[model samples]
Target chain A: MGGKVAVIDYGMGNLHSVASALEHVGAGEVLVTHDAAVIAEADRVVFPGVGAIRDCMAEIRRLRCDELLRSALVEQHKPVLAICVGMQALLQRSDENEGVDCLSLIDGEVRYFGNPLTDSEGTRLKVPHMGWNEVQQMKAHPLWAGIADRTRFYFVHSYYVAATDREMVAASVDYGVSADAALARDNLFAVQFHPEKSATAGLTLLKNFVNWNGQC
Target chain B: MALAKRIIPCLDVENGRVVKGVNFVDIRDAGDPVEIAQRYNDQGADEVTFLDITASHEGRDTTVHTVERIAEQVFIPLTVGGGIRSVDDIRTMLNAGADKVSINTAAIHNPELVRDAAQRFGSQCIVVAIDAKRVGDVDGQPRYEIFTHGGRKPTGIDAVAWARKMADLGAGEILLTSMDRDGTKNGFELGVTRAITDAVEIPVIASGGVGNLDHLVDGVLEGGADAVLAASIFHFGEYTVPEAKAYMAARGIEVRL
Candidate 1:
């Protein structure tokens, strides 16, 4: 799949790993840019970010990436993938920084994993939930093509997404709580985990994204 | 299933070459850091960490170059530690494609560096590496003190309390190493390991003295660590990463395999 791929960068986090991962998988002409014209010309767009939601939204709005992404996902019907904080930014709001408004592209809100997060056995679970965890496919989608069910993916975040529209959730994972792992609606596919840093399983997911054509 | 505990194989690099110095003495060359990282990645290692022990300024560039090659090929979480003194150092490593930068002596020198780096790069990329050793007993409890300069200098800081402070200051994870047990192959200092893991809400990577695969499991089961790190055990070809994971999985511990 040697098509132009645009990786949206708004200075919120590192783009090296994502770009390199895409290139490593032979995804053609991976461009890490904030330029709207380049993104508009690309066959696909990857919305990737890390850090706090408040700062992410600040940059997104400042650079008018919100409008760019809005056009890509809402109007153009292009295949768009959002990752980590990039996924959280698509929600209506988040509990971080005492609450911050998001893109509302998907009907959802981000909730913290709790200060003293505990399992059913009353054992305290770590925050940042940083490690590999299984992603159970909730609904069938194109991206899950070659990937097996319950494949482990790398995750690192303090908050998790809860979509108001349950049908949008494509996969779920159990931390201290059952959290939405991947959400899908039409042409947009977003994941709460970093597929780039997730190794083979992650590379397979990104490869599926490269080959997907905005179809269910 | 819940989050699987990670088994990280750490590489001690000097001048872009992997080296293992027992207790900071009698160093032996292992291989290329990039090659070693890829081998571990193939064997299903959860993540790879590079501890740059290069003391010379000229040799430091090689470490960055080594990280660049590994990040380009190995698509896993890569952490670079050792001699990371400032925010610029953190940025340099991250730009070179490291997922996290672990700061050890620097965090003790300027405690604010931890907070500053976390705020600048986000907590997910900031790791505070604590090299501590048992100092004595305090009220019938084993007391540990933070050590810097390759476990030669004492900071007079409480190990458990310092882990809490680093977490509150915005460290994403803590790489806790026991200097006493580092090269002895006796296993981790479980007492202090459990103490720090329970003290903080963030994830902790237990390091030092992983003589065998059982020590890896013990680090998680007994020490309550979110992850366990070892260098020589995997580096010396004594055991492969898949074998370690299988051992842990057979013992009823959740692993990726």
Candidate 2:
């Protein structure tokens, strides 16, 4: 059941890696495009980004990805998957670079992990939180199929989301403080980790997304 | 579970081929960079690092092609170091599908490159690699000076201070290699590893001088390193990446096992 998948590209981050992973998972003919017409015609869409929120938003607007994303999720109701900074972009605002506006697909604010991030043991943890950490599944969704309850996913980000709507929290991770790892509403699923680089568990997640029919 | 300490298998490439050498001398071929990298990925390597040891202009271009081949297949995080001199070099590698590019000689020459690269491509994709050698003590304290050209030349910059400076300059990680212990199989230089790890808020990847699995564990627990990188032990098939992870996990260290 391989179908077309579109990976949004707005001159932010490495879009090729995302496209390669999708292709590797046999997700049909994956297209990394900025054209709205191309994204509008795909069976599924993957929104992926990296770097600063302000710059990401700037390009998202410059390329009109913001409007495309809203229409894809609201009007078209296509299955949308967002990764890393792409997930943070779906929030209302962010604390990075002294505050920046976001896409606001979910009612949330992106807050920095803060300087001197420490655990319960009082040991200081590193910023960017770069490494493999377990994501505790909060609820069962189609995306969590065949993956364990606390499978590890690769994460590299300074700020995290604090969603106002608690039900959107699909998964959570504890890194000094608990942060939302994955957020889901109906057709849209967003994660703060890099599943493409997360090894076996990550590949399984992509496989699940490929076959999901946009039904919870 | 907490964030697992990473185990990265470093491949030193020359002329687009993987090689293993002691202190960059008496070098011998290992295997194809992409094939070896795929084996490590199957063995549960947290990340893979490709250090292009090639020096010639044509060889550097070959290294880029090699990186592109590996990035197309290996889905895990891939870091390419050596010969990354300009923002264009970093951009080329990132565009070639590298998750991160580690800067060494270039960062020493112009520290602004770190800031510029980080600002342009985000801090998460930029890693500053420090090749440090121990010098004489100053006021009853041991001092480490940065070295370049494969640890043959010395730069008067303090290793710890440089790590702090690079972190402040927006570097996301530090790949600290001890020149004295590199390729010695004596284990990591825990002293300087802990020193730099504590000095910077960003993650430090303790590299060079790993012989056994315990050495991998020590780099994390004793050295305070967030990750450990080794070449020979894993290259020659003395031990696999999964063996190293299982060894670290059994020692009460958090690893993705």
Candidate 3:
């Protein structure tokens, strides 16, 4: 069989939508599996999550998806894509559900976008940060291939990634705060937005990710 | 830059077909739901809302086949409503590829449905649609009451107050439709729309009574809506989505066009 694409499912996130998206992007034999061996055997792995971080981490630990993801990125050096809560889980900790510890794969923290979210002009912006917004590439990366700079992608989240290292922030978007929209370090790439629902730009990114070889 | 005020084209679907009429009378087929959704996506629609008008009466779930078809071709955010009553229903739609689901009658009947759905799914995927009309009273406050069953029955709840309650109940957004102005083409009921928008912190989608491009401008500028939703104008070929966006952008309102 050709190299398969595995989408790690810990029973959270819209696994169906992500699988459908991966299939649409011509990922070729996309498998949504909780089995570790199957995931490890795949050439590329995708870890996607949604909903609260507490429950997300609970299920991740339950199914040992955390270890699966770690090995995929650290040991195998395979191209691993983390999306939304999946991206947040890669960080050290998150201030959601009061506070929750994360995988600490990346040296960053996930924090709430505090109520009364407003731009510099003091005008209110909605939480959940719904709808499409621009993401400007911080540095060139393989995943950003074929995608233009500052292209709009669909975002639906309240918590955002705050990395201490500017070098890790591969792309940034202004959502009241200049947040890191996408992060890249070594073989790992994660984005706060839902590329699956991003329409043309989103689908194109997924296609690029499927074709991407773990490179800087 | 600030987030652009969205312009959405809603499709009223029945028996898996897009239908149009004035106040739900003498319904006429507009086009296929999947085809219409793709056309809007190509025409630069900010988002699309599909209201399955027959699901409730038939005592069935959402039109998943149609939603799946639309989701395949149209890539933007899709929100499906009508007969979305429970968490399972929400999951079914999301599984079929809808980004969000709007609950109206069910949410009003079972307010916990909103909280539960928001908790199970993320609040971002839960939208509480409140179809309302101004209840002119003799002795009490002149408040807008919530209407369900295609605006056929009016609940005694106040529209603005219920909006605040739904936002508090974990609804990520509010889809506000004015029953009085729905098919009259007079424009959105600005007073009630602004009232609900100001009352809630979440984004509010102002729906119903969009007859022209100028009405869309008014929905955002005067009504204080985060988005403007219309069907007849866009369906009847009165104005293309991009053309409407251009009209709004020329008037100094931000749009994705």
For all the models shown, what interface RMSD does each have? 0.9, 0.7, 1.7
Q: Which regions of candidate 3 fall more than 4 Å away from where they truly are?
A: A1-3, B59-62, B137-142
Using all chains and alpha carbons, the TM-scores for the candidates as numbered come to: 0.98, 0.99, 0.96
Candidate 1 chain B least-lDDT 10 residues: B53-62
- When only the first chain is scored, the TM-scores of the models are 0.98, 0.98, 0.97
**Fraction of reference contacts reproduced per prediction?**
0.81, 0.79, 0.38
Q: Which tens-of-lDDT digit does each residue in B95-167 have in candidate 2? A: 9889999999999889999999999899999999999888989898789989988889988999999999999
List the candidates ranked by TM-score, beginning with the highest. 2, 1, 3
What's the DockQ for every one of the candidates? 0.83, 0.86, 0.55
Native-referenced Cα lDDT, model 2: 0.91
Candidate 3, residues A38-108, lDDT tens digits: the string is 98889999999988899999999999998999889999999999999999999999999899999999888
Cα-based lDDT for every prediction: 0.91, 0.91, 0.88
Error of 3 at A47 (Å): 1.4
Q: Clash number for model 3?
A: 0
Per-residue error for B69 in candidate 1, Å, reads 1.0
State in Å the error of residue A125, model 3: 1.3
